[model samples]
Target: MTQSGFDTDRPVRLGVQLAPQHHDSYQVIRDAVSRLEDMGVDILFNWDHFFPLSGDPDGTHFEGWSMLAAWAEQTERVEFAALVNCNSYRNADLQADMARTIDHISKKGGETGRFIFGTGSGWFERDYTEYGYEFGTAGQRLDALAEALPRIESRWAQLNPEPTRDIPILIGGAGEQKTLRLVARHADIWHSFVSPDELPHKLEVLSRWADKEQRDTSTLVLSNELGRRDEAEARKLHDAGVRLFTHGVSGPDIDFDSVQRWLDWRDGING
Candidate 1:
């Protein structure tokens, strides 16, 4: 797999979100991983949520890190991660150690860049309160994330056998005051839940912040969720210079057919 950067040969990439919450989970995700890799999807993402974001409030949900570990071992091609790992769930050091473990799993047979550490300041109130963690204010969580990112980066270096490649950091959020600014400084990939009309302004702001930080705006992998399965919509984002497009499906019994269609579209566009 190619390491994501300004010069990656692929002009656009498509990823699928296997929502760990609200799923048959174990089997649903396991099968999904192999199928996606076989179908040639670029990345597999699972949201970090303790409770099902949709469906029953008390539905079965698997933990993110462990699922990712399994995915690392199970799949040979696709890169995987929590679409946005909740920063409030684990300490910085522990998260780094877990990431290192996953990196090893993905590279067991040989070195392959099949993991991306996508993280964010957690927003769900239920996750923290139910898990006995402090449900601090948004600002507090973002501050913790800003501090933790460097530590996670440092810990990767400290590991005896380093990652297969420089583990790319994917940060998610659109908070202009804090999140986007941090993205400008630290993110290898920045994901946002924004509408088509709103993206141009956010891109401009991100570009300005990159200028101030002396970072190349193009260096950041711009990712966003595809709200609908419209080819034109995906192309619109690509035209705006967004290269990574993501679509999500819940489990219990996922419809991989739709995801396959998106993958086809991705290939057709890039081809």
Candidate 2:
């Protein structure tokens, strides 16, 4: 269970993307948040989209930011965020305002808040078309995202009391030209959907960009979504320098066993 390139001394962090598109989303998310936090998960995330990515195309999906506010109120120990919020869905300043509000909610008690502002360029064409947003080309969307990042960060500062803390930005995507560059400039955490074999090259590219920018690449956390349920494979990923792991499952019957296995792996790695 030894993780290569990772500091075994540092506590391993496990995260889950609670699909908000299935069953009674409001209640399911509430219950899952409580259960996962109690089960010792480090982070909980929900996807930001209007329609279900899986299951019925027009399933019972819920809005991301509102659900997050509820999670901030309900959970105490686990950090919460959207796996990657769609920047095209909301205005940049407004997105920052929503995050700041959630940060305040999570920190209502004596303890500090835990909300990572994970976001990216919008991709689901259905979401944009149905919601009246202009479904621009991929390049155009990336351009918008690049412009929005700074405004989102700046607005967080202008908000009263600032944020509960420095809200960590987690950008999702592995596109070499746009996504990796954006990650180097803005993200505290970079999430890629590819397998481990593809990761080393991307990491190297990011490192090169970081070097050019005079930024400390080590501070940017490398994260990836596990595609299969093999602990050995997950371990291999850990050995290759991916510290944060995420997996997706549809709702109604969430594969809790899958979640437990990941949690167990995280615990064993840290121990």
Top model number, lDDT: 2
- Candidate 1 residues 167-214, lDDT tens each? 888999998888888888888888877766677788778777777888
lDDT of 2 by residue, 167-253 (tens): 999999998888889988999888887676776777778877777777776677777887674888777777777788887766878
- Misplaced by over 4 Å in model 1 are 1-9, 108-110
Give the TM-score comparing model 2 with the true structure, all chains together.
0.94
Number of clashes recorded per candidate? 1, 0
lDDT of 2 at 172: 95
CA lDDT, every model vs. true structure: 0.82, 0.83
